[model samples]
Target: MAGKVQKIKDWKGSEQKGTLKLQEAEVPRAALTDAISEDILCDLAELFKVFGDSTRIKILYDLFSGEKNVTEICRDLEMNQSAVSHQLKILRTAKLVQGRREGKSIVYALADEHVKMIIAMGIEHTEE
Candidate 1:
């Protein structure tokens, strides 16, 4: 039952001769469906999927410093131009990063604060 307390076995080495003590715990329920819609969930899943790529993560981390052209990104990451551009395209489609024309190159950067915050949170969580 949602939000109901129930007694369950502790599974620790506290068992008695012929009986076991039960611990009171709350059973988890689906809490997200009430707060998020299916479409939003799908979009969130897609957003995370985009983050699943290592190349994209590197590009985002590079952008965290400041805007840089694809050539700069390629040099910083030691990757080729086309590979970096492809990852940038995915990041752009996910709205995690953006680019602008500077001279003859497109200088890329994180789209907004939320992106930087997301990556920062991920770093913090991993360290924890």
Candidate 2:
């Protein structure tokens, strides 16, 4: 198993001492330090949690095409306004989507290019 770490365990199911193997190339020290902060790690976890909901994922996929209001999302997803709005609030809080006032309605869109890239990469990974 290239690039895999193997932890040797004893009969009691406890990890053995000094049997850890890093069989592949070592990870860069800079890469290790860059992601070590607890706050950043927790934030990343929270962001992924936001993506765990099917409703939120559909809303994000809908927004990928362009900005749409609550009504449009509900119609497109065949859901009620309340449910769509609730998921939209979650998406907005996670900074995955943004809304702006247009006349009397609020049009929602992907927060930025990073969000599009994230969704695109996710789709690509799942398709494979």
At residue 16, candidate 1 shows an lDDT of: 36
TM-score between candidate 2 and the true structure:
0.72
RMSD of each: 14.4, 14.2
Which segments of model 2 are wrong by more than 4 Å? 1-33
Give the range where candidate 1 is weakest over 10 consecutive residues by summed lDDT. 11-20
Q: Candidate 2, after superposition: displacement of residue 93 in Å?
A: 0.7
lDDT (10s digit) by residue, model 2, range 18-57: 1222222334455544546898889999999998888898
Please give each candidate's TM-score: 0.72, 0.72
Give lDDT tens digits, candidate 1, residues 1-118. Answer: 5354444323211223222233443334444225788998899999999989989988887776678999999999999999999999999999998899989889998898667656
Model 1: C-alpha RMSD to truth?
Answer: 14.4
Q: What's the CA error at residue 33 for candidate 1, in Å? A: 10
With a 3 Å backbone cut-off (N, CA, C), the pairs that clash in candidate 2 are none
| Candidate 1, number of clashes | 0
